[model samples]
Target chain A: MGREMDQEPSVRTDQQLIEDVRNGDRSSYSELVKRHQKGLLRLSMRFMKDLDLSQDIVQEAFIKAYEKLNLFEGRSSFKSWLFQIAVNVARNKLRENRYHFSDIDDVEIGVNATAESSLIDHAVGNILQKEVDQLPFKQKTALVLRVYEDLSFAEIAEIMQCPYDTAKANYRHALLKLKEVFQTRADLHTWAPETNGMFNEMNAKFAEAAE
Target chain B: MTQKRFYADVLLKQTLKKEDRVRIPTDESFYEAMNNKIMMAIESSEVAPGNKWEKPWVFLEPGIELNEGAGNLRSRLSSKSK
Candidate 1:
C-alpha cells in the first residue's frame, strides 16, 4: 500500500512525457499514443465516417506525430498539435477519396428499435448527420471541432490554419445551415420542450447575424 | 470570445453523443491492438531508411486490417522497403 501510494504521485503530464520521449525514453511515446488515440479516432470518424478508414487515419497521425516530434515547438498544447496533425491527415484522405462520406444506408443504428421514441430519435439523428455531412468541409470542420470536440475557437483556428474570426464564422455558418432544417421540419420542433428557449435564442442570433 | 448558445447546437451535441455511444469502441483489447499497431509502425519506419518513412500511410493501405499483429506489419514494411 505504501509503494502504491508513492506511485500515485508520479503521474506525469503530457509535456513531461514528451520531454522523456525526446530524451530517448521510447516507452513515453506509447503513453502519448494511448492518451490521445480515442480522441484522434473520433475526430477522424467525423471526417471519414468509416471506422476502418478513421482508424487508419488515426494510426498515420500518431506515426507522423512521432516522426515530427522535434518540430512540435510548444506553440500549442500537445493535444492540439496532435489533433492538428490528424486533421491534416484526415483532410488529405478526404481529398484523395474525393470527399466521400459514408452512404446513409451504411450507418449502424446501435440502439434497440422496439421503442417508438428510440426510432424517432434514430430518424432525427440521421437527418442531423446527413445535414452535417453535406456542409462544406471548412464549415463541417468548424462545427465538429466546436460542438463535438468542445475545442476553443482559438484551437480550432490553429488546427484550421485560419484566422480566429474565420473559424467562428465557419461554425456560425454551419449552425445557420443546420437551423434551416429545423425550421422546415415541424417534427424537429417537438424534439424536446426544454429546447424551445434555445430555439428562440438561435433565431434572435440569426436575425442579428443577418443585420 | 464567448460562443453563443443555441438549441441546434445542443441538439447536435446530444445526437452525436448518442451516435458515439454506439460507434466508438470501448473494448480494452481494441485499444491494446491499436497501440501495438502504432508502435510497430513507428519501429518499422525507424528500421527502414527512405522517403517512405515520411509517408506512413504507405503501410496503411485502404481496407487493410490493422489489428494483424506487429510481426505481420514488420514483414509488410520490410517488403515495401525492398
Candidate 2:
C-alpha cells in the first residue's frame, strides 16, 4: 500500500527531492517528510523509546536538517547525512534526560513476554518507551541506530563522530544493559515477546550457571 | 490467541494515532517553520558543534570485562578496529 503511494511522481527522485528541498520547494519537502518520517521516528524511538518524544525528536531533527541542508555538500549519501542529524537530536535528548547507564545489571529481572494484559495495553501496544528511556544515553542511541535503523557500524561511527569501535561497543553495551534492565525491573517483567524472550532467556541461563 | 492478538492490534492502533497527534506540521506550515529555522541558522554565529555532554564516566567498560556474556561485545568492539 505504501509502495503504491510512494510511486507518485509528486515525490520526485531522491536527487531531485534534495535539490528541490534545498531550493525551498514545499511539496518536495513534504514528500521528503513522507518518505522519511516513519523510519526516523523508529530511529528516534530506539534512542528516546517514548513515542511522543521520538516523534518530537524526529520533528526537531527534520527542522534542523532543513536548516543545515544548505551546508550539505553531499560528501556521503543524503540519507546518511539526514540520519546523522537524527542521531544528534536523539543523543541530545538522551543527555538532557540524565542517563548514566551505571550498574544496570545489578537490578536485572525477568520481563513478562505477554502483551495481552490491560486496557492501557489495549490503548497503545506495549510501551517500551519507558524502558528504553532508562538506557544510558549512548547505548540507547547506539541501539537505535543499529537495531532500529539497521545502520552499519561505520555509518553509525560517522554519524556519531566516534571511532567505529566506540559505536559497536556502545551498541553491545546497550544491548547487554537492556538485557539486564528487563530482568531486574519487574514492572517490565512482561512487556513484549522480544523483550521478555531475551530477558528470560538470559536469566534462565544465569540461573543454570549459578546452580 | 485472537484475544491476545486483538488487544495487541488495538494498542498498536491507538499508539499509532497517538504518534500521529504528536507530529509537528508536515503540510505548508512545515516548510515555513523550516525556512524560519534555516534563516536563523543563516543569520546566526558559526561555531563547531561538539557533543553538548562529554562528561567522562569514571568506569569505562571496567565492569564489562568481568562479565562472561560481554566477551562477544568486547570482540565486536575490537573487530571494528581491524
Candidate 3:
C-alpha cells in the first residue's frame, strides 16, 4: 500500500513538486516531467515539425528548465515557464542547424474526421496545413499557441516574448491570410460546410479570448 | 468571426489537429525516455547550492546588460588580436 501510494503522482501542486525536487527527492523530478512532458512534446512538435528534433528539444528544454528552476518567480504557472524554456531551446536549435519548418506535407489526418469524408477531409487538411506552415514565423507561432494550444493571448505573448497586442495581431493576420487563401478556392464552400462546427468552436474561443 | 474568417479558422484548426496527431507522442516509452534523459542530465550536472541554479549569466529584466558586456568584451579582444 505504501509503495502504491508512493507511486501515485505527487498530490502537491507544481510549486510543491519543485520544492520536492529542490529537497532532493529526485524521483519527484521524474514525476514532474511525466506530468508536463506530453504538453511540452506537443508544443515542441508544433514548432519543430520533426519528431526527432522535437524530442531532442523537449529533452534539452526540460534539462535546461531544471537547471534554471531557481529563476522561476511564480509570476507564471510552471507550465508556461517551462514552455518559455522549450520555445527558446527549439528556436536556438533551429537557428544553429540552419533548419526551417518544412511544408505541411507530412501531416496525417487524425481519427476525429467522420468516416464518410475522411479522404476528402485529409486532402483539405493537407492543403490547409501547407498554408499554415508557410505563414510568417510570428503569425504561425501565434496561431499555434492560440488556436491549437488554446492559450490565451496573454500567455501567448508571454511565451513568444511579445506584447499581448502583438500576439493577437499575429493570430489575426494568420486568420486573414488563411481567409484569403480559402476564399479564392472554388471548392471552399464544400469544405466550409463540412467544417462549420470547427469554425463555431474556433470563433467562440477567439471571442472568449478577446474578452 | 466573419463568414470568411470562420471558414479559415475551421480549416486551420482541422489542419492543426492533423499535425498534432502525427507529431505528439502518445506511447508509454516516450515518457520513459524523457524521464531517463532528465535523470541522466541531472546526475551529470553540478547541483547548485540549495538545489537551485547559479545566477544566469544574464539577468533578463530590462536595463540589465551585464552579460551583454561580456560578449562585447570578447568581440573587442578578438578585434585587437586581429
* Candidate 1 root-mean-square deviation in Å: 11.8
Interface RMSD, one decimal, each candidate? 11.9, 11.9, 10.7
Q: For candidate 1, write residues A100-162 as lDDT tens digits.
A: 555557766554546656765666667778888899889989888877787667667767877
DockQ score for model 3, please? 0.12
Model 2: per-residue Cα lDDT over A1-211, one tens digit each: 8887888676454556768766656456656676666667666655554666776777777676666565554433456567778887877777688544323334333334563344324322233444455666677667656554556666566567676689889976765554455457664445445333543544454344334
Task: Flag the better candidate by TM-score, 1 or 3.
Answer: 1
RMSD of 2: 12.6
Point out where model 1 deviates above 4 Å: A1-5, A8-10, A102-115, A187-211, B1-22, B46-82
Sort every candidate by TM-score, greatest first. Answer: 1, 3, 2
Docking class of 3: incorrect
Candidate 2: Cα lDDT at A76: 35
For candidate 2, give the lDDT of residue A33: 70
lDDT of 3 by residue, B1-82 (tens): 3664455466566656664444566689868977898788877654355334443232223222222321222333344366
Best-to-worst order by DockQ is 3, 1, 2
Query: Candidate 1 or 2, higher TM-score?
Result: 1
Candidate 2 docking: what grade? incorrect
**TM-score of each candidate structure, all chains considered together:** 0.72, 0.50, 0.70
Please compute DockQ, using alpha carbons, for every candidate against the native two-chain complex: 0.09, 0.04, 0.12
Candidate 3 per-residue lDDT, tens place, A1-211, comes to: 9987996664566777788777777777777788888888888887687888888888898887777766765544577678778888977886789676444456554545466376656667667777877888789888877777766665666677777678789998988787666545655455556765553444444454444
